[model samples]
Target: MKYLIVGLGNIGAEYADTRHNIGFNVLDALAGASNIAFTTDRYGAVAELRHKGRTLVLLKPSTYMNLSGKAVRYWLDREKIERENLLVVVDDIALPFGTLRMRTRGSAGGHNGLKSICELLGTEDYARIRFGIGGDFARGQQVDYVLGQWTEEERRLLPDRLKVFGDAILSFACVGAERTMNLFNKK
Candidate 1:
């Protein structure tokens, strides 16, 4: 089976290590652990990983957060991967820090990246993994908070959290979204 694992984040050093870039961070960890490397590719950075007889095509969109759907659509078509086998990793401020949730389909919940994906894909039925970045900012500071670098404490805890995130991703591609959600949503 083939799966498209998209990690959404703005492409630039300014965006690196920010809370909004958790998707990229998770993909990086997964790739590193699997001894794979990403290469610059059309609309994104691309990497291939094999797990349990499944091929996972990892993507970190260069289209930036708001325009992520362009890259996603391009890769999905190029890869000829079914929408059912697609997974998007995104940051969520609704949940507490380090929390993770997997859903088969849902609204974008004010995320522009997800909104673009939903719009371009013409449906919200794809799977997504929302990684919590916490909602500790004051009102109207949402943008700054998301693009901000992690706190010292958060940095310390991130490696462990990312490992779990990577594991959940692998579970989704290997065992299917339903089973993976049941296994990781409680974490």
Candidate 2:
């Protein structure tokens, strides 16, 4: 089977290591562990990796966070991957930091990346991995917090958290999202 695993984030030095870029971080870790490198492609930086018998195409969209759907749609059509085989990795502020949630379908939950994707895709019937960045900011500082760098404590916990995110993705490809969700969502 083939899967298009897209990690949503803005591409630039300014956005690097921010809480909002956790999706990119997860893909980078996964690619590094698989000994693969991404090449700049039509709508994103893309790399291919295999786990067991499945082919996974990893993408870090260059379309920026709010316009991510264009990149996703392009790649999905080009790769001929089924809608069910698409999984988007995105950061969510709703859950506590380091929390992971995999859902088969849902609303955007106030995320522009997801909103654009759903708008372009014309449906919410797709899978997504929402990595929690947590809502730890002051009442009016949401933007700053989301775009801010990780705290020293968050940095210490990141490697292990990213590893689990990588594993959850692999599990989703090999065992299916439901099983992966059951396994990882308990943590």
Candidate 3:
């Protein structure tokens, strides 16, 4: 079995460890735990892993946030993986911090990264794991908030959150979107 895991984030030192880049951070932690490293390739950094006789293709899109779909599309086609087998990890400001929501299909909820992917894929039927970054910003500061660094308290709590995200990714591959969603989408 083959599965494609796409973590949406901008590629740069400036974006590292920021709220919008939590997707990248989760994938990085997943890669570390799997003892694999990502190599720069066409569209993004790619890592391959095998678990329970399944081959997993992990991608961290270098196309930035708004253009993430380009990398996702390229990798999916190149890997010959079906859209249903793809799982996107992204930050969500709608829920409280440390909250996780997994969905089989849905709208982007105003997320440019998800919007790009949905547009390029021509549908919103793929699976995605949304990591809540919490809406804790002043009025009209949404952009700065999403792009901003995590607070000291959040940073301290991030490792555990990333571990959960990584486990959710593995569960999605080991089981399926429905089962994984049931297993990980805790309030």
Candidate 4:
């Protein structure tokens, strides 16, 4: 089976390691663990990993966060990967830091990247892994918080959290969304 694993984040260096870029960070860890490198592609950075007869296609969209669906749709069509086999990794502000949530389907919860994906795909039925960045900012500081770099404390705890995210992604591909959720979702 083939799975399209999309990490939603902006393309620029300015966005690197920001709270909203946890998706990219998680995928980077996964790729590093497998010793796979991503190459610049038409609309994103792409990497391929093969394990136990399954092919995992890792994508980091270059279209920025709000326009991520364009890259996602393009790759899905080009790769002919089924919608059911697609998994999106994104940051979430609703949950506390270090929390991970996997859902089979859901609304975007005001996340621009996820909103774009749902708009382009016309469905929210695909699987997604939400890495909680926490809503710790004061009122009207949402954007700054999301785009800002992580605090020193958060940076210290990030590696282990990312490992959990990587494991969840692999479990999703090796098993299935429901089973993977049961195995990895924070309770």
How far does residue 46 in candidate 1 sit from its true spot (Å)?
A: 0.3
Q: Give the count of colliding residue pairs in each prediction.
A: 0, 0, 0, 0
In candidate 1, the residue pairs with backbone N, CA or C atoms under 3 Å apart (3 or more residues apart, or in different chains) clash, namely none
Q: Report the C-alpha lDDT of model 1 over 49-166, residue by residue, as the tens digit.
A: 9999999999999999999999999999999999999999999999999999999999999999999999999999999999999999999998999999999999999999999999
Question: On residues 40-149, what C-alpha lDDT tens digit does candidate 4 reach at each position?
Answer: 99999999989778999999999989999999999999999999999999999999998999999999999999999999999999999999999999999999999999
Over 4 Å off in model 2, which ranges?
none
Candidate 3, run of 10 with poorest lDDT: 178-187
Q: Write the per-residue lDDT of candidate 3 for residues 57-150, one digit (tens) a residue.
A: 9999999999999999999999999998999999999999989999999999999999999999999999999999999999999999999999
How many angstroms is residue 102 displaced in model 1 relative to the true structure, after the best TM-score fit?
0.3
Off by over 4 Å in 3: none
> Residue 122 of model 4: what lDDT?
93
Each model's lDDT: 0.96, 0.95, 0.93, 0.94
Global CA lDDT of candidate 1, please? Answer: 0.96
Worst 10 residues of 2 by lDDT: 178-187
Q: How accurate is candidate 2 locally (lDDT)?
A: 0.95
